[model samples]
Each structure stands twice: as C-alpha cells, then as structure tokens.
Target: MIPFSLLDYVALFWYITFWLCFSWVVDHSRLKHHNLSHLMNGHRLRWMRNMSTRDLRMVDTAIISGLQNGTAFFASTSLLAIGGGFAMLNSTERAIQLFSDLSIPVETTRALWEVKVLFLILIYVYAFFKFGWAYRLFNYSSILIGALPYAKTADEQELEIAIRQAAEFNSLAGKHFNLGLRSFFFSLALFGWFVHPGLLIVTTTFVGLVLIRRQYFSRSQTLSMHLLPEKE
Candidate 1:
C-alpha cells in the first residue's frame, strides 16, 4: 500500500468538508431571497390545491409516475456505476499502466488506486440508496394521491387535509431525488482526484459553483418564481 501524504489527507478532508457544508447550506440555509427549492415548494402547494378542486387527478398521477420512473432510472445508473468501479478494481494494474502510457503522471501506487476506486464505488452506492428510497417515497405519494377523497363527495376540510398529505410526500420524494442527483454531480468532481489533488479541488469548486448558480440564479428559478404569488 502506498502511504498517503499529508496533502493527500488534507485534500480528502477538504473534499468531505466542502460537500457537507454545501449540502447544509443548500438544504437548511434561510437566505433573504427565495431559491429554486423554495419556489418549487410553493408550486407543490399550489399543485395540491388544484388537485383538491378537480374531480379527476389523472394528470397528477401521471406526474408522480414520471418522478418514480426518473428516480428508478437514476438508481439503476448508480448500480451500473458501482459495477463499473468494481470492474476497474479488477483491472487495477492495466489501469495504472494505461495511465502511465498516457503520460498522465499518476503518482499513486496500485493499492491507493484501488482505494480511490472503492471510494467511487461508495459514492455510487450511497446515490443508489438515496434514489431507491426516493422511488419508494414517490410510490407512497402516489398511494396517498389515490387515497385523496373525491372532490364531489368529500368536504372541503377533508379534501384539503388529504391533498396536503399527498403534497408533502411528493415534496419529500423530490428532496431525496435531488440529493441523489447532487451525489452524481459530485462524482464528476471526484474524477479529478484520480489525476491530482489540486485538480480535485478545482473541480470540486467548479461543481459547487455550478450547483449554487442553478439553485439560486438560473432561468428555471426565475420561471418558478413567476409561478408564485407576488407577495412571495
């Protein structure tokens, strides 16, 4: 096993720290202005309200099915990525030689390379679990949607309560799906680690900036805000 240098350890620690900090800021921070997530949440509430007014909610069911199918696709992709990582681990020597032949200057030993591959596998495994759970939550949300009382038969209060429950479940499933996608984004950054720690830092910063921009300042966020009330 090749021993990691102090810098290598620092790079790994920095990577983890930044990931955790970014996730917390995105999910928990209350900024002065609304982000995409906040706007989407407003839309979710509006969707449920609309659902309560309609006698038929086939469209809503279709949307929920789309979400479930998307989550399942991502989960399957994550599993495939894990399998690819394992395949890489099996051909560690060939991989190392290929890097050497490419004049890529990979300074790590075979053991370190294997460990990095394992780390990648771990990331995908975590993503798979997140996506899998998100898919299940979407299924639950669909069930809740089906359980909602019909507009023609139920009182206003009962309809409101049911809609609210279904909306909350859908929102939660969306949250987990976003988390899984975030992991996939970070995995792209992690690719730089195989080349150099400095490259990893640069790529991580780039990914973080891209995510923040899309979350808070993208055109999609603007459109979502337009869907909300002026007071919001």
Candidate 2:
C-alpha cells in the first residue's frame, strides 16, 4: 500500500478540478468564441471555402500534410516520454536517493514514487492516443478535399456541402491536436508532485492560468482575430 496523507489527496483533487475546469473554459465556455482556437477554426472554414474555387488543390494537400506531420511528431514524443517513465520506475532507488536530502513537504517512498511515475506515463499515453486520432482525422479531411467537385462543373448546393464537410473534418482534427498538447503541458506540472503536494497544487494552478491567458489574451489571439479591409 502506498503511504499517502490527507494533504496528498487534497492536492490531487485540486489538480483534477483545475484541469477539468480549464478545459471547459477553453472549449465550451460562453466566451470561448473570443479565444485563439475559435479564431483558427474560422480560418480553417475560410480556407476550405476558398479551396472550392481553385482548380488545382496542391496547396490544400500540402497544408494537410503539414498537420499530419505535426501530429505524428507529438505521438512519437509521447511514446518516448512513456519509455522514460518506465526507466525511472526501474531506477526507483536512485530517484529516492537523489531527493533524500531535499527539504520536501513529504518523505519519499518507493511505492509513492512509483505511483507518481505511473501517473506521468498515463498522461503521455492519453496524449499519444489523441494525436493518433487527430492524424487519422487529417487524412479523412484530405480525402474529403479530394472529393470536392469543381466549382465550374458542380451545382451550388453540392459545392457548399462539400466545403462544409471538409472544413468540419479539419476543425475537429485541430481540436484533438490541441488536447494532446494540453496533456503535455500539465505533465510538466506533475514534476512538482515529486517534491511536495503543496508545490504540486501551486504549479498546476500556474500552468492552468498560463494556458488560459494564451488562449484568450495573448498577442496571437489578438492577431488571429484581426481581419483585413474588404476593399481599398
């Protein structure tokens, strides 16, 4: 049995609550439309709508390829992080020794260390699955793009439907990719757990705030929401 105290439970509970609430605020809140992710979603819709007017689609295919490549990189990184976690589990004594002299909030134990490392591995695994699914969705979007009819030959209604379908698939892929990256950021906060439960709570709160700011108040968000003049 792992030796965990009341403080550990409280810290873990807060960590989970912060993560869930942050996810909701970014992806489902009433003001989510003002965020960077929502802005990019609109850009994706416009990109697909414009694709319908072009005779050649090489530009569209290249952009999809880039999305797939980015997703694949993150998936591979998750696997590597998982392997590192297992390696730490095998060297549990060394990790405990390294922290033995530090003035930490809690004493280190083999069982507790193992649990922390396992949680880290679990997070990366979740990210890997998300990236994998996002990659496949990008592939589906590419196929949908290929299926779009030429604007000159297709009926107006059919072209509109095809454009909407392609845009939706692309947007869904972006959402999953964002989720995978979110896991990676939170996993960094987990390091504070190896030191102290109180520190863990503080670190998680800080990371959550940073993510929220980037999504809603960063320069990128401001720039993404900007539009060019329609005419001179």
Best by lDDT: 2
Compared with the true structure, the alpha-carbon lDDT of candidate 2 equals: 0.91
In candidate 2, the residue pairs with backbone N, CA or C atoms under 3 Å apart (3 or more residues apart, or in different chains) clash, namely none
After superposing candidate 2, which stretches have Cα over 4 Å from the reference? 101-106, 228-232
TM-score computed on alpha carbons, candidate 2: 0.94
Cα lDDT tens digits for candidate 2, 1-232: 7899888998999988999998898899988888899888888888887888899999999989999999999999999999999999999998888788667544789999999999999999999999999999999999999999998889999998898899899999999999999999999999999888989999999999899999988999998888521221
lDDT of 1: 0.86
Model 1 worst lDDT window (10 residues): 30-39
Residue range 95-169, candidate 1, lDDT tens digits: 888888876677867988988999999999999999999999999998998888877789989887897898888
